[model samples]
Target: MALDSYDLYVVIILVVAVAAYFAKNQFISKPESTGFLSNDSNGGTNSRNILETLQKNNKNALLVYGSQTGTAEDYSNKMSRELSSRFGLKTMVADFADYDWDNFGDIKDDILVFFILATYGEGEPTDNAIEFIEFLDNEADTLSSLRFTVFGLGNSTYEFYNAIGRKVDLKLEEKGAERFAEYGEGDDGKGTLDEDFLSWKDGVFDSLRNNLNFEEKELKYEPSLKIIERDELTTEDKQVSLGEPNKKYINTSVGTDLSKGPFDHTHPYLAPITKIKELFNSKERSCVHVEFDISDSNLKYSTGDHLAVWPQNSNENIEIFLKAFDLNDKKDNVIELKALDSTYHIPFPTPITYEAIIRHHLEISGPVSRQFFLSIAAFAPNEETKTKLTKIANDKSKYAEEITLKKYNIADALLYLSSGEPWTKVPFEFLIENIQHLTPRYYSISSSSMREKSNINITAVVESEIEKDKRIVSGVVTNLLKDIEINKNKSGDKPLVTYDLKGPRSKFENFKLPVHVRRSTFKLPSSSKTPIILVGPGTGVAPLRGFIRERITQLENDVNVGPSLLFYGCRNENEDYLYKDEWKEYSKKLGENFEIVTAFSRADPSKKVYVQHKILENSAKINEFINNGAIIYVCGDAAHMARDVQQAFIKIISNERKIDLEKAADLVRSLKVQNRYQEDVW
Candidate 1:
């Protein structure tokens, strides 16, 4: 029997894993399928054998994660690394969705369990963790023998901050699970997620050491994988992957890997940009309306779903990183990496090139973590460079000023300190171990699934600004999107952003990019008769547009509709009012049933009118709608607008119902519990 290309790739990876496992202290090639590589990590028949696997591997700690966008999974892996290296505790990372709940309570008493969960949209569990949450909710086992700790990852901007994590903590306690340490919460809203985790882990370690009789060792550098450069095979070789994302995209001469496969985050569809146009009239900034042709792909999305755009790093940036590391000469040289330790998991496939690793796998743009800075300082070109890095790492005050305040990423920091010097002494494996993986950026789908089932639309405001240092700070995905809009429109003008439009091997030459659909809880009411009140400011109107478009389709089908009000806020109506003509068309179809209230803050009014002010102005009508079972939805900036809108609603309820502040708050909470007040805030 002959093996397919993907199968061959998998076998090669398995072989690497086995070889690495056998090497023990030596660096060898070993591969293990990681959760960060996909949307769902529970794929095989052995998924339910978590307990058996733990015992077989002699692991004492099992880190289970419920993640939507890989944050929790990444944290889980980090915990695994720390546990295995520093505490001398054998650990295994597992997806919550993989194990069966029926046997969840039967796990051995010797093993410690850790839950690193992220509360997603509207306080809902992630798609993969849904079944697990439900099982925990339904099962009646006491779980008396279970010992666990939980750390929640959530945005404080949402009403239910860390709701899933809170639920799990309470439920586990109720089921008699002993908690060794106080549970922690990491807030993404304040941009202190990493700092919060690092802080919490120290307390957790103290508790673990006290409870489990554990000893902490001095932190030392441990190499998990060894990198071997192959000079024989060049970039032109058939099997060489020059930044191709997956096995199906390897571009072998035998034939195309036309198999559609699963259109999940792991295996994305190369969706073509069917149509794109600038939405606003302003020239200084850009907000593009893009349409993707998904007819040939198996990616299905609802009206309020999100589209994950896999972006490519700029060629100039990749080159700068290569040169900084003194690897520009051997950019295409094939390298095989093998894990030296059984606990360490390879993030990506082995036998890839330096260019592919730098361009495709690693996140080269983000600001450096304090721990990462400490790790890389040891490999600095000179003692002076090392001293400077060590100073920044040791002095918390200086770190906040130099790294955080200045927003210096790895490349910028390295280039600034070691000017004209290549840090060639840094091991390739160390770089791979420290740098984070490049993940996809998600955008709200702005087109109705019904109006254009095969075509998905994305509305994004490009984030590009000239920093104080005269350096351009830009978003990777949004800049890529702007480039696509430029290519489609044939705008000969100087672009606000630029990109290497020709992707790996020109796979994305025709403005095609890898994409996948992520179903969101932010959706329109199932019934057309259900009234909806939408509050979306700026590009937050992305999902609201989809809702209104669906309502338009329903009206076209001659179905009865209810009151659908949209409160959209922007700086000015002339410069950035979005979908103006389309709203007018919708008004014609459903005369009194549809209305769009525009709040133009910069229309040169006597006062700056905002979305919350508009909501308050129509408080009487809003309260009436709420009394009549209307569903209220809020989107956009979660920190300010969403918070203000919620307060405005609370005030309306207080005045309308003639209740006290406490009672009004309870009423609002009830609405959220009933799913009447939903939010899709960022």
Candidate 2:
């Protein structure tokens, strides 16, 4: 059969296209980024090398991090530094959400990659890692050339441990990506996160050395930053930060020009405290409900969201830390910290004073780790102190018994090790390098956004205990809050702890502190008609209060609302029944739609009861709601209450549905997968 000339040409074109497709599969194009980006010390002013096209970069390694709350970020930066310092590899650290992986297939065998990812909230990726997780989940571009390893940070208490890390590893392998080392996992539950990281890192270094013939170098301390003391400038200078969180907050309290900027992690709104009242009627323990006015700031928070309160180190802790480092004399010296390495930057904006850093920006009271102590033991004051420090660091059992069990912070430990002698030999640079930045404490919002959008409420119990020395040990954030509340409610009673709450040279002149709202996945059901069951014991009632308040608001607005059941437990009805009067009012308004199943552990000492026990007493009604498609919520202690509540639900389902324990557990797992079961536990 004779074919037309056009048909023959089409047939030839098809043959050429098929051949080209096979050739392309055999040799995919490499990335366009190849030039090495220089550091600040290297005298080149270029942007981040990782952001530059990857294939064009001469560096053989790239570290990408999916961090929430900065731990993974810290790990990623450390990896970048170590890779460059030891292996002679030009390395760069990048945020997981920062780039598109359209060029993912271009990774070559010689170029290694690393992922330091944190699994947040029940096997879920962090908010920042959401897009990248979806990209990895949906895309199937073959990366036969790629080589990588992963280190996952997770809490072992959760059901799906290190799910993101495991899923990503499997997906990458399926796409033909090879591993350089076995997958690493760090568990916060075992209190071995630091040890796990160190152990995994050592193994990775060995693997890299064996595979790439990488030569190791002596562990020399390289300053990622350079500090400049400004004798000409005072801390009052306009350009100086003075421990203010951001540029807008530099003169917020003093100058009228300083107005509230965008509310974020760096720029917290100095929301004023409006009201404070103690909920518990006991002197040994105190629980207070404090309110904040955010009307002036453009901050918006919904029910179940979290409010982060930026805290200052207690005055006593600050003084002790300064004395340990012998920095008390030069506390007011204004200094600027500049980045010396491209991958490194000061955690906070600088030109801040030593006093400000110590008082408001550093965590001086937190427990010290063994690895951190060993890193600075070489600069100890005397032989005796150095020997003790080294022993504590080297002997794990001794470290746990003597250091960890005592809960001695860096200042406390150093003072004990030095026998109260100030360690003047240790450099100030070493102290700054070792101490971590102060992190804000997050409290669940207790007020309904629907009831009062401009105001925020939180309930916190002051954490104070008398030690053997009769000295009080208090939480860094909660004690400061107690001080503020004392100043507000002056009931002729002095605070259990004191803070230099007038922060940064009295710039925070009033009781006001820095604050920001952290959005949470723990939220009320979108529909008001969705039957919801919540278990919140102690301060866990914080978010559940907001949930109930919202439902009442819905009832007020004439919106159809459904039945809501709350299980709350406390020590005694007369002593710590938090918001007792308000619950009565809510009951009167909602009638049968709302019910409070209470458990007072102290009310009946013979057979102490918990929220889960109360749950058992009302299992039939609870199961009815579950069968009617109710969503379940739990908040409070992850180690105890949350787990107990989960177990209680499994039992109820097994009994009501007449199924086996394992089957009921599977159903509960499915509910979690579908977001019908939610938790906000610490």
Global lDDT of each model? 0.81, 0.79
TM-score of 2: 0.89
Q: What are the per-residue Cα lDDT tens digits for candidate 1 across 229-281?
A: 77887777756667666756774447654436567666778888989898889
Query: Could you tell me which residue pairs clash in candidate 2?
Result: 32-56, 33-53, 33-55, 33-56, 33-57, 34-56, 34-57, 35-56
How high is each candidate's TM-score?
A: 0.89, 0.89
lDDT of 1 at 149: 91
Per-residue lDDT of 270 in model 1: 85
Consecutive 10-residue window with the lowest summed lDDT within model 1: 38-47
Off by over 4 Å in 2: 1-60, 79-89, 97-111, 251-261
Q: Which pairs clash (backbone N, Cα, C closer than 3 Å) in model 1?
A: 16-29, 16-30, 17-30, 17-31, 28-338, 29-338
